[model samples]
Target: MQHAIAILDSGVGGLTVVKEIMRQLPQEKIIYFGDTARSPYGPRPADEVRLFTRQIVDYLAQFAPKMIVIACNTATAVALDDIRRHVGIPVVGVIHPGARAAIKSTRSGMIGVIGTEGTIRSGAYEQALKRISPGLQVFSLACPRLAPFVERGLFGADEAEDVVRSSLEPIMNVPMDCLILGCTHYPFLADAIGQVMGPGVKLISSADETAREVSAILYHKGLLSESADIPLHQFFCSGDPALFKQIAQTWLSEQISITPVIWQVPNIV
Candidate 1:
């Protein structure tokens, strides 16, 4: 096995997970695919999202990865189990790790969650948290506009602050000691979100915990790479390569190459 960890997202959001993985497991090689042309899977129907996710997974499997990470919360909510059952790899998702971190970080037992409408509607984080701590109070808000803004590469822009603040207004009335950025894309808007939520509220990004889970799984499976050389990382997107590459370089702080992959058209036999 090549021992590479493959990751997929609806769009650039998954880079958040990649960032954490690179920081914690610098030796592991990564192959990432983003469905940017049909970005923002959060609003699509479950079946449609599942189909899209499967299509991308089959495409990524060409790399013969040892594991796959479903870095988008909406996709993880709708497609993680289906992909895992058929893919036969150690597949990880952002929901559990994020919920676990939120559960631990909330000292007041009041936690708030913000994510794409599809993710919030799926109740994956709420379910995960309750399964672990039934008594904990959970409040969730669906920010339908956040993901689209992120996909457009508008983080930290002047307009982003107002959009983020408005989307988070619902949760401001709720008393939460911890707030989980339930969607990977939410981290890019954290500054605006933090400004609205104030300093006392702890913001939890699933990236760190999800990375740790990936490390743990690889360690347990004895798939940890022994190569001392700087590992190679490849990125592919189903959208504009230039935009994806620009964001990837800025996010990773390195000049990494991104190859463009188009979704294959099936022959009508």
Candidate 2:
């Protein structure tokens, strides 16, 4: 089943997962959808988030993707099942992989998670961690503005350092040995996060783990693409297409065409 893969997020964060997928499965074509118009799905109601995610899955399904990767932890926690059912495709989300990786990397059983308000409030990462190992301690922090700040290209700036440090101070002060970047956009601030977290802690980006799971699922389902010609990936955003494209190239390490859409068919599979 050599076919294109669809990856979705509320904003630019999902591109981190897409980057990993591109590196791991270079032959696969991708169609990435970022609902930037409704960016920061974290604070919205769960049902609304589910509906928004379902809509994107339906839109991407029209492309006949073999799999749909939910690259947003907030969405994964809130809507993975809805999107999967709506699209009827091999759907994957970031939560489980990130949870597993955090558990694996933690020696003190203390795992810290930083994500959007939605993800932190959802407690999906905590549930996943506890479900795997009930004894593991989980700390969650919400960095609501962090995503947009990164999207605005302020992450690498010196001024952003203080915000990053303050935002993560609580988590850093904790005894956690592993920190899960529960939001895709959080990786853009990895350097700042790492500096605040100190060298002893291992930072886990769900993007890498999530991409690995995507590859595994595609391989097992026999949907892995085989084109040696190098597949082309297209990006689309509901808001500023040019800005979205710029952010995509910045994070994914490649430039691609991005178009603006009024809306992608909003429905479940």
Candidate 3:
């Protein structure tokens, strides 16, 4: 049996990373778990987020995955180290990849970060960025409403631009060359965000960077899948299966021609 890469997130936001993984490592099997019932983990307490992450990890352990990716920024902020300690497999988080990407993309040394309350509060990006380049300027904001909006699969709605505009008002004139979509869910609203941020500022999503990291880690460990056959990916969620299926199909249909098998994991919650 193929040892799949296990990815866990607060909701459909992690599909961003999944899309990149499918493109970069086509042969690897994937086992993804989305805790949609507790969708917006942004505002939740750190301890609570840690608990929820642990529960999801414990559940995903059944698959005996070769690696684990914490696709949720908020959970990664509070639980990455804990999850690393809990699991023996290679564990990756969205924060550091995103911070590194932002650092590399910015020419002005002025970086803007937009994420959930928990992520912003933890200052994980700020720390990660400063740890590498101490002189860089970092501006962090908590847009608590955006994640929930994306969770509802309304990113394409007409009002999305307006919502993104309002949420980004504070940092509009910050003079940053690049803005990091610190939360995975933010990428779903990337079009609207780009319009709001305008032509000057480049938008960075950790999805691509995180996917690259996964590929490198697997290669270094000699864990890269050698199978020539197409791998079937499995998706599980703790909430509305219909909504999860709809979002997954809409985002991934272009990359994966075969429809994914999605299961509603009621017991995980």
Model 2 Cα lDDT, one tens digit per residue, 1-269: 34688889988888888888878877788888888878878789999998888778767766888888999988999988777667667889999999988877888998888998888898898889999899988888998878878777677689787989878777667888889999998888889888888998899999999998888888898787767765767777777676776676667555333222323423332
Clashing pairs in 2: 55-266, 55-267, 86-268, 86-269, 87-269
Query: Model 1, range 63-148, lDDT digits (tens) per residue?
Result: 89999999999999999999989888899999999999887788999999998889989999889999999999999999999989
Ranking by lDDT: 3, 1, 2
**Model 3 spans > 4 angstroms off:** none
Q: In angstroms, how far off is 54's CA in candidate 3?
A: 0.7
Model 3, span 1-269: residue lDDT tens: 88999998999999999998999999989899889999889989999999999999999988999999999999999999999999898999999998888887888999999999999999999999999999999999999889999999998899999999999999999999999999999889999999999999999997878999899999999999988889889999988899999999888878754557778776654
The TM-scores, one per candidate, come to 0.94, 0.92, 0.97
**Model 1 quality (TM-score):** 0.94
Against the true structure, candidate 2 reaches a TM-score of 0.92
What lDDT would each prediction earn against the true structure? 0.86, 0.82, 0.91
- Candidate 2: misplaced stretches above 4 Å? 254-269
Candidates 1 and 3 compared: the better one by lDDT is: 3
Ranking by TM-score: 3, 1, 2
- Evaluated at residue 233, the lDDT of candidate 3 is 90
Instruction: Kindly indicate the candidate among 1 and 2 with the higher lDDT.
Output: 1
